[model samples]
Target: MPQIQSELSFNGLSVLYQIAHLLASGKDLELIMSNILEILETSAGMKRGMITILSPNNEELAVDVARGISETDKRKGKYRPGEGITGKVVATGRPVAIPILDAEPTFLDRTGARKGLKHSDLAFLCVPIKSGNVVIGALSTDRVAVQDAVTLEGELRFLEAVSDLIAQVVQTRRRDYDRIHALEKENLELRRSLENKGKPDLMIGNSSSMREVYRQIGQVAPSITTVTIRGETGTGKELVARAIHQKSPCASGPFIAVNCAALPESLLESELFGHEKGSFTGATAKRIGRFEAADNGTLFLDEIGEMSLSAQSRLLRAIQEKEFQRVGGSDSIHVNVRLICATNRDLETDVREGRFREDLYYRINVFTIALPPLRERGADVMLLADYFVKKYSRLHDKNIERISTPAIDMLSAYHWPGNVRELENVIERAVIVSTGNVIEGHDLPPTLQMKDASEQGERNDSFENLVAAYERELIVDALKDTQGNQTEAAKILGTTKRIIQYKITKYNIDFLRFRRGDSTGDDE
Candidate 1:
């Protein structure tokens, strides 16, 4: 029986101990593998050491780490199961030793590490790396061919032991990696929930109804569905359309907005579908239509209810076919655009009256988003007012900071008939006329003091009743702002949580109503 020299056996033992220590010390897998290969080359007289791991499907082997190998060679060093000598070891769960590589007909140097060597000087060894009873990968190296077969066999055994150590480390890391991946997925879901709890950027609202709107935006933004936004005029329909476009997959592409109500039937048709040079009277140049311009992006058509029957027919065909021809041009032009339509009119009523096509309405209304008017939105009135105040103040370069209490009262008491647009206009005009940093009640239009004439004599209309109603609205707004967190709401209002709790109980306010989903953000 032949034996490894005492000095070589001691060196091998030392290398194995150090590798085991590195794995135990929690070094990174890539660094440990690289260090292991270096040890084999320097201490064990093995050169060009390589490690390959089996893909999860076990169809091919991929080089995980290697010494004296270029990135180009490493990328090309893939082998199907049982295709090469290294692949055979991993497939059969056995070791392979080629004492004279040139003499072996099956030896294939895929990595090209041994270009000019023959059987007399170069030898190769490959062993399976097994985790328990399953082969997971392989480790291979080249060395000087020894004359005695027993000496080479002993060396192969030592390599097999090293391969086992590598397998153990890989198995442990893979388990840890799977656990971390699951945790990250859970964290992503939590973050999405929190995003829904409040107003996202580019939108303003604290009401639960508007939170639902935000949720809708989140759901629809990632898709290319045709969205029909319905709301009262001036209720920020265009902004909702823009939000959808900015979040969709076509966000990087162009965003084109067309106000269907602003143009005549003839001009609208030409504008939307494009006209060729001299197609009609005054056609000077070939114009690309909205559809072509908005290709690979989003197209927003506002006031869809205002489009004429003649134009609507052409629009329907363009959307359904995803292709159209320029006016006076015969060539078919194809376009890929996400369509968003908005209407303040009751489209269903129009369809019933035979003024709008039912088929066309259904085509664009694949996903409908109904925006609440400012009056029904409750506390969102003051929120929008404050936002407008800050926006115009910055634009007009004013030092305005707060809205006076009396002004807030007038804002809350009177109903806004024209919705958010009316509120924004009122604030812009007030900001211009006000002499002080605070917008006083007198700075507002007199029309606000006399509520709407239509709503006159509808209730008791007492001063005390008005004040109590205003207080309730303020508290409800604060609760919404804090997502029903009573402590945070009190802090925002500069009051104590106990007072907030008392008022909540007395007013029969359900704070949970302000919460959008399964959130424990509110204090019990």
Candidate 2:
């Protein structure tokens, strides 16, 4: 309610700074307007301040926020076009300045906002917040001394500058709606591509852990060093490699990707190093390898940990010397290509265990980035879940507007062993099956329902009941792992089949109960 003095408040540059500071807080728009009024009152030396927003119909204006309007009178009073001086100011689409409140014949006093204040002693200044070339809303202030109206010079000019800024805010927010809609559309197209024998390379997460990923990318992208990305399978290691390629110096060039694990040793050797005609039985013609194809660009080697030992030796030579001969030819085909390798396996551990070559590991590990599994990103799970739902809904031509809050809670609680890749698949599946505007917890995959019962926050439960529920789930899970092949299950579980059978029967271990893919286990 504190107002600023006029001479010090309504100046050029200072107002813009204040407006930016106000917007940065991200408060409610109404609260923002109230603060604006209070600042005008204190700094502009106004007795009272009010701001009216134009309704969509444009026939009436709503008193969105005010500094001087009492709660009781505010509920009883409202503003309409051509009713009072404020309305006339809006209707004329120009600022109004009444020197003497009582001398103005057209003035109508309906604001019973203040009790003891003489109506005639008040002077009014009102200007509209414009829409396009026309006025959409009005900003009006009350001054006690009529003579001070002229002294409060340049107030209208200051307000008009702010009006322009508010217009920009509205325009920018309208663009956000369009952007959000467009993002949904792109997501839909990507989902369709994914459903029809295609892959979308989804990256999901906004946690601090994910921030580390972005940071590492920024750090290494400017350099020309070989990078090795490590994480569990389905954790988006390839996506990380792609991000590195995108942010790197060779971004404009080709980004050739090769899966080291998917190809056979012979085929992989030919793939990495170009082959001549008749290099092998299938080599009917010459072929360019990934290295030559990615010349002056970047080559992304996926599942690098699975590369054959012989291929590893050849790869090390090519990486270290930047030269390699074709599979059947002796000519040294030199190419300048940045190397980026991704794998779910721990290359350091593999090297120590003698499964991976230490020299190759060191060469590729010039820079390393490790991505965390999805469950570790906290609220980022919900962020990504909503993104996917909106995306797939549009792609599949569905109408899922949102995911319910409970569904978000379920997402946060569940452990995504397959990481981001698995979470995205689950969301796509739910979007395909969901039948409402919002996705609910029941719509989620069965693995999410395997509640950590020992946690006190299973909706509600005493500590003792929580523990009991946990024990119940564990016993049921152990039986499920056996898959009703009880004798073998029992031996693997280190218990007699009879005792396992007793627990199974006690916990209702019928495979039919777990029939909807109900078994919840972590693969990573």
Residue-pair clashes per prediction, in order, are: 0, 8
List runs of model 1 lying over 4 Å from the truth.
Answer: 1-200, 459-524
Off by over 4 Å in 2: 1-204, 452-524
Error of 1 at 176 (Å): 49
Q: What lDDT, from 0 to 1, does candidate 2 have? A: 0.72
Which residue pairs in model 2 clash with each other? Answer: 3-42, 4-42, 4-43, 5-42, 5-43, 6-43, 6-44, 188-395
| lDDT (10s digit) by residue, model 1, range 245-349 | 778898767667899999988899888989888899999778879888788888889998999998899899999999998888889999999999999899989
Across 79-125, the per-residue lDDT of candidate 2 in tens digits comes to 68876777887788877777667677776545566468775787777
